[model samples]
Target: MDLLKSLLVSASGLKAQNGRMRIIAENVANANSTGRTPQDDPYRRKIATFRSHFDKELGAEKVELGKVARDESDFDTRYEPGHPAADANGYVKLPNVNTLIETVDMREAQRSYEANLNVIESTRTMLQRTIDILKS
Candidate 1:
């Protein structure tokens, strides 16, 4: 029963990490995305926050996505007067997404996801062994 509860908690973590990964992927995909018009703002970086909640059924704290927030930091300015999205002063606002930071976040999320998957695998193996022992 305890193992099952642990597995459930880990499953929640996996789900949360999966969501985080998706957001990271989206950020990477849109890193170079610019505004359609001069008045529009460029793409802002998205951040994922995780929170732990008590699960009565599992009797444990499980992780979940708290919020997907937009990074409010100012975008980088580039001198691209020829660009279509350039401002009147010949400056273009670049997206706030930093490829290096996103890549690191993605790697961390992938590792966390894999760790949760391993926990599920081990829990399932233990459960199967217990069932086998009881059958024998």
Candidate 2:
């Protein structure tokens, strides 16, 4: 029963990591995106938050994905006179996304996802072994 609970917990972790990876991917994909007009704002980087709460049925504190929040940091500006979205000063506002940061976040999320998968696999293997021993 505890093994099953661990499996569930790990599954929750995997789900959270999956959501995080998606956000990171979106940030990476929109790293070069700019606003349509000087008055408009480009894509803002999104961050994934996690929280743990007691599950009544499982009787355990399980992790879950929290709300996705936008990064409020200032956008990078570049001077490009010919750009359509350039401002009066020939400056264009770029998305707050940084590819390097997104890449690092993606790697971290991948590792966490793999770790959770490993836990699930290991639990299943042990459960199978226990059943085999009982049958013998």
Candidate 3:
């Protein structure tokens, strides 16, 4: 039962990390996306939050993906008078998405996912070993 619960917890973490990875990917994809028109806003970076809930059936605390919120931080302004999205003041609003930040987030999420996978794999191996010992 404990092993099962452990596996469930790890699975939840994997799911959460996967969600985070997806958000990071989206940010990276829209890093260069600027507003088409002067009146339109540029792409905003998306952030993922995780929630922990107790699963009665699994008897463990499982992680769940929380609301995907947008970063409300100020958009970067670039002086591009020739750009279509440039305002009358010759300032263009660039996307809030930072490629370096997104890249770092992606790497962190990947590591977390890999860690959760390792936990699941280890749990399975331990369970197998226990069964083998019982048989012997």
Report the lDDT tens digits of candidate 1 across residue range 1-136. Answer: 5997888899999999999999999999999988877888999999999999888867888999988999999998889899999999998888999999999999999999999999999999998999999999
Off by over 4 Å in 2: none
Q: Which candidate is the best by TM-score?
A: 2
User: Model 1: which residue pairs collide?
Assistant: none
lDDT of each: 0.93, 0.92, 0.92
**Counted clashes in each candidate structure:** 0, 0, 0
Q: Please, what are the lDDT tens digits per residue for candidate 3 over residues 37-60?
A: 899899999999999998888777
Displacement of residue 115 (Cα, Å) in model 2 is 0.7
TM-score of each: 0.95, 0.97, 0.95
- In candidate 1, how many Å is residue 77 off? 1.7
In model 3, state the lDDT of residue 34: 93
TM-score of 1: 0.95
lDDT of 2 by residue, 1-136 (tens): 5899999999999999998998888898899999888888889999999999999999887888899999999999999989889999999999998898888899999999999999999999999999999999
Scored against the true structure, residue 94 in model 3 reaches a CA lDDT of: 89
- Candidate 2 worst ten-residue window by lDDT: 59-68
